[model samples]
Target: MGRINGENRDVVFEELWKLKIPAKSSVFAWRLIKDRLPKKLNLRRGQVVVNGTLCPFCSNNEEEAAHLFFNCSKILPLWWESLSWINIVIELPQNPRDHFLQHGNGNVGGIKSTRWKCW
Candidate 1:
């Protein structure tokens, strides 16, 4: 029913509205959506020196953006609980782009969608 289900993610690069958030967080979300974040898994794969690919927050599983944000045992419940405060419960997507797109799906280009994308 929305952009969340779309496969053509090149459009993600066009959404400058997300940059309205603080620059650091905006850049982080940008890297995250593009799957370009230097998570431990990516660093190791790129031949960077990392002791392990484990999630630092959980000490379990490889550290990918999806794992860092949504799938970590420590972060997962916190996300669910925080969103519930605003009555926004969701089953977070494992794919990073889809995860951001799910948040951006509502109200399309408005600040609400942009803020979610930047978060």
Candidate 2:
């Protein structure tokens, strides 16, 4: 939520809201960027009881948003599919905010860039 490594939050949000996607998708992205989603780790932080905190997909690590979405062994292939469209692949940042920003880096500008951000 605060400035990320000096990157302005307003600019990041401005770009985020400009994507041609559904409002619910935008809301989901906003929650993801802000770490507000109810991932298992987040739920535990609020003292909400659940059956378990391990990732439901991989069952190998805590189900944090960053891990579930960006680093999970079960989810990486889906991310790779999208990255392959750009003909590039790079190490993804663990933080959701950083991952969102970096996911679209080095992309061509205009609609393509918009699509990348949306993805």
Candidate 3:
């Protein structure tokens, strides 16, 4: 998807669509990059009643995309382990789009790069 207001397409989105992933996975990434997932905070903002906004895993703060995927104590380790398996040792970006872009743009080449991006 391009800009909602008819501006130039975002590079992140352009790169996102080129990934050799399933359509559903690509759509999920698009929603994640746009911060449009129906996480608790987003649901509340959309006027959908939520019992509690706290993250289901940690319950330490309002459930938002950033916290759920990046900052959550329970989930962050999984990210680390996944990265480590691929020999990546860099600090993770806090924003989901940044994280995706970083992982998708690894220094490897061709199939390896695509595989890392997919991974």
Candidate 4:
């Protein structure tokens, strides 16, 4: 995956808005990506050894980016709400990165701060 910084950041953020993923600020976008990663993958969560760490949102499996952002029931409602707030009606991407990178050209002035906070 590419770093969301410099010109790449602009490209990603603009693409995200175009994709109707939500017009949140770049900081919020970064946080959303971080939140999507599995707890095990997050070094800040501490080391994972012996029994595998499970996803906090879904105990059924490890909390990888795909699971947390795309598959977790806990996060689905948030995703739906985010899209709805932006008046975006479309199918979500299968991968978290793809979802984050989606871009659409619709008017995105309706995006809300709460949506970013939720991320």
Candidate 5:
């Protein structure tokens, strides 16, 4: 018995060479992105909705990622103040995974803090 070539492995590899994501962190990230509850609640398709519709913070139809992260009255000011303190401007990603991954990095302490505050 030997390994076969051209196998479509859907499982994520533990080591990605230079990416160096911790195993727990990688699993948590995947769960955040792949979980079905958010999709069902948000009415997104295949956990990959990108019509720039529906707010991530609130379930409003017109609320895109940008609005949710930087324009919505409920979350905008808090995020703005946090970014101002850090002196960085992150362009919100259309995909929830990208947005979460980018901010999940240790450098974005403010973002992490804000997430906690929200929860």
Candidate 6:
């Protein structure tokens, strides 16, 4: 692989290995990073009917990866509460890549670092 592509893939593999979430959860996270999750917008783009393209949680805007995961009116509070319980304060990024990266990349170590990884 080219240098840049290899480096990017390395980062992804590193993150996936570091996240101590369940196997299914880690797989879900991997799909999220690849932008391969079958969100409503993705389905729509694939010519699949979704009734409405708006976000199911907020129903305020088009259903997309970033909005569904981080920017929705409903899910953000839950995410914040979960992270806040562990003493991590976060403002969800509008960008999808940034949002995924914001999850458990702290410098801490051992059990605490494992605990800090996203669900």
lDDT of 6 at 117: 55
Please tell me which model should have the higher TM-score, number 1 or number 6: 6
For candidate 4, lDDT tens digit of each residue in 2-101?
5544544554444444433444554555555546433576754656453555778778877577776677888888878877876767777776555654
Per-residue CA lDDT of candidate 6, range 1-119, in tens? 57666754556557676765788988887787778899887888899978988887778989888788877888888888987888877677786566655554665445665565555
Q: Candidate 2, which ten residues in sequence have the lowest lDDT sum? A: 1-10
- Expressed as tens digits, the lDDT of each residue in 1-119 for candidate 5 is 13345365332221211134566655555554454234333545557645565565676646544454445667867867777876667665555445555554554446453352222
Q: Tell me the TM-score of each prediction against the true structure.
A: 0.76, 0.83, 0.87, 0.50, 0.37, 0.78
By descending TM-score, how would the candidates be arranged? 3, 2, 6, 1, 4, 5
lDDT of 3 at 118: 70
Candidate 3 lDDT by residue in tens digits, 1-119:
35676577687788778888899999988998899999988889899999999999998988989889888999989988987887778887888888877865656446766776676
Which ranges of candidate 1 are over 4 A from the true structure? 1-9, 16-19, 109-112
Per-candidate total of colliding backbone pairs:
0, 0, 0, 7, 0, 0
Model 4 scores a C-alpha lDDT of: 0.58
lDDT for each of the candidates? 0.76, 0.82, 0.82, 0.58, 0.50, 0.73
Off by over 4 Å in 2: 1-9
Candidate 6 or 2, higher lDDT: 2
Residue-level error in angstroms, candidate 3, position 62: 1.1
Clashes of 2: 0
Q: Kindly report which residue stretches of model 6 are placed more than 4 angstroms away from their true locations once superposed.
A: 3-8, 103-105, 108-110
**Higher-TM-score candidate of 2 and 4:** 2
**Deviation from native of the Cα of residue 6 in model 5, angstroms:** 13
Pairs with steric clashes in candidate 4? 15-103, 18-103, 18-104, 19-102, 19-103, 19-104, 38-63
lDDT of 2 by residue, 66-100 (tens): 99899999999998898898876688888888877
Candidate 6 lDDT (Cα, whole model)?
Answer: 0.73
What's the distance in Å from true for residue 8, model 5?
Answer: 7.7
- Distance (Å) between predicted and true CA of 52, model 5? 20
